[model samples]
Target chain A: MAEKKMGLHTIKLKNPPSILSTATIVGPKEGEGPLKDYFDIVLEDDLFGEKSWEKAESKMLREAVRLAMNKINLSPDQVDYFFAGDLLNQIISSSFAARELGIPFFGLYGACSTLTEAMSLAAMMVDGGFADITIAATSSHFSSAERQFRFPLEHGNQRPPTSQWTVTGAGAVVLGREGKGPYVTYITTGRVVDFGIKDANNMGAAMAPAAADTILRHLKDTGFTAADYDLIMTGDLAKIGREIAADIIKQNGYDITTKFTDAGIEIFDLTTQDVHSGGSGCGCSASVFGGYIYKQLINGNLNRIMIISTGALLSPTSTQQGESIPGIAHAITIERSLEK
Target chain B: MEKRKENEIKNIYQQMVQKKVPQSSLIKDAIFAFVVGGLICDVGQFFMNLFLSFGISKDDVGYYVATVMVFLGAFLTGLGVYDNIGKYAGAGSIVPITGFANSIVSPAMEYKREGYIFGVGSKMFVIAGPILVYGISSSIIVGIIYYLVKVLAR
Candidate 1:
């Protein structure tokens, strides 16, 4: 098992876990976005028939997991492990969802990178003979996040242009030991990197260096260049962080300009959406990957892709107490199996 | 040496962030604040005039105008329109008595989900608490200072 480990922080999976199915559920705002057609469920209202935004967020994750399970006619009992998280205090969205799904759960918190983090862990579990099947899932709600992080939902305050709109969505993916293609091939876990960013509003800028660092490390560890993957997507760096990350990567001898994109940027129409930076939160990458990118893979349009989700680890109290925001990212490489 | 390196790193990253992150348009914000704020004040003035025309005393007119303005702010917030105005209006909508009402009512409304006592009742003053704390305490300090000055002059 030690020999499976790649250089530094990366590992090359011996028996890659194949993604059997995926389910993405998004709010109307995202349903109206560019990749609208890829989502399995587009909620009419954000409430999802729940009284509170927190409950609705949990319901979204629950519904996403059930829907993913239903896609392959798999039951909750069939799922060996459920790894999930969300951008809520105590990760209530995931914990509540776990209680409903009743699959042996591991509640994770890596901020917005939680989905990728879950997937990395789930894939490892499947590959190591620890589990035959595992589920990776996460969610985030705009209203819930705003209340917990910044201000009240109806607070009469202006957001800075650098502020990102948390993508209100949830997504779940089922990874199994047995599947035909689109396997989780490599795992690159990121280290916490802080460049002394104090502003919570401009998280993209804070997380950019971490995103770039992960990408660079993944490439070096695997001895693969940027040209290897069909696409390399960062989680929620949005417009500001995406540019900074790509620039940093280019400066460090790896040119990923053309092949690089971000889940935040692609999930919204930048000009018309009015989401200053772009879409973010845990669901940004989760929904996009489950809805859009997975479709591309299944259709054989994209043979190989690397997804690196960036996260800004900071609480309101931490920012209030004058602490710099630390950022982390996790990269998961999924490739279509070349076997006939 | 470690602190110096940390500071150097902080300085370089701050520079990059400043360059990349889009700045709020001060000119646009100023204009929006001015127009919206002026419009709100105009409504207050209109109410004051109408109340005075009804043979109400000048001393009582001020009370009526203030009450009406505060009511309007709370009302707009309930209708979910004040935040829309605040989004673009910035200080225009936020500086007025209406903004103060908004500051109180918005949290109460948001925390309604948590329950009436803990959520709405307790958190309602979360945002407005600081204003009251400083505003009233400062006035008391001024009052004591005024009294001392009067005593000293006598």
Candidate 2:
């Protein structure tokens, strides 16, 4: 008989990886969010005393990684691999940080979804016994992303209401085979889904469908319903994308409206922040997960939670060529350690 | 068969995505543009009057006014005040000669670190290149047409 798999896309790890420690660093805007208290450091200046935004982002990521390691009483040399990514072209932020950290590095490119993508890979490495300890991290800066993806900041183009603000922050999580924390139980890798969304400004709409698809597939594969998990979080969907995702999932017979929340929406006080559609970036979900979600799990306030980090795979060249944005969402299920 | 399944999925996804497209307020944007644009024009007219008062010839006043406006626009862009105005005024800041000055200087300022030839020089005309090309080409075409008409009439 063939070994049974968990649905079509899910993987049930034989050795569950535990989240040893996590750290988050955010900009002034993100620091003003509801979960501000949970983050490790909140910089008053987005530049973090750096000359350029790109360098600032790299510095933030390095600091987050160091903080996470410090919390676990481990140094950079002790960590097996550093899995990191960012929204910048060629992921220079992560690459430059990796060079500084001097660890076995695996740079990822998942746009806004990079957090969960890195975590999923890190979990797999720990579970598969490939490595004992690994760090998963990602960062995004508003100034850097704005110039790279859209017009220059000085252009003063009126941002449409559909546009989501990129969170200027970084989050890092350390995963290991043994730890007194939440266990990464399962992972569901997603497929790139394109809905023919041509507007580059409205990233939430482009990535929402992928979030819904991954959520539905994850539920099916894991043989779990909406009620089974305390929370079902989608990364960077913000306000507009969250509603669209909820509707799509409901149409497929999964009504997770009450339990569903989004990192983008949760990161900011929408009314006070004036962040039109809310926050959307690799760091949006990463910081929220590392700071808020992990804390809740460790405190026993929540049990099982599934995070589906959504990414829009579009380059400047691709958008200029009039190609529709393709989105992907990677899901990871984390549960409070029963032994603890 | 595979292609058909993919298309079906694509159609459903597209329908769902279309529902979430945020609506833009046409009236508010128009009001901003109108007020901003009008104010910029008023500034230009003020400059024209100022030049005429200084005893500049009527024919030369237009050139001097344009020079002043362009210089002001570039200067404001460098000082970072123009961006704030742009934020509030929307098209008001962009639809005028100041906007043109902003377009060129902003990119040049941004790419200055990459060195003169590759960074600033190459990217300097990114936003204004097309406008220059079309503007010059159309003027030449109009000149040729006018010459042909004059010759034919004679």
Best by DockQ: 1
Clash pairs, model 1 backbone: none
Error of 2 at A5 (Å): 3.8
What TM-score, to 2 decimal places, does chain A of model 1 have?
0.99
Top candidate (TM-score) = 1
Query: What are the root-mean-square deviations of the candidates from the true structure over C-alphas?
Result: 1.2, 1.9
Q: What is the lDDT of residue A117 in candidate 2?
A: 94
lDDT of 1 by residue, B1-154 (tens): 9999988977987897788877899999999999999999999999999999999999899999999999999999999999999999999999999999999999999999889999999999999999999999999999999999999999
Query: In candidate 2, which residue ranges exceed 4 Å CA deviation?
Result: A1-4, B1-15
Q: Against the true structure, whose lDDT is highest?
A: 1
TM-score of chain A of each: 0.99, 0.98
lDDT of each: 0.94, 0.90
In the range A1-340, model 2's lDDT, one tens digit per residue, is 2242488888887788899999999999999989999999999999899978899999999999999999979988889999999999899999999999998999999999899999999999998889999999999999899878876666656778888999999999999999876999889998998888888878888888899999999888877899988999999988988998899899999999999999999999998987889999999999999999999999999999999999999999999999999999999999997553
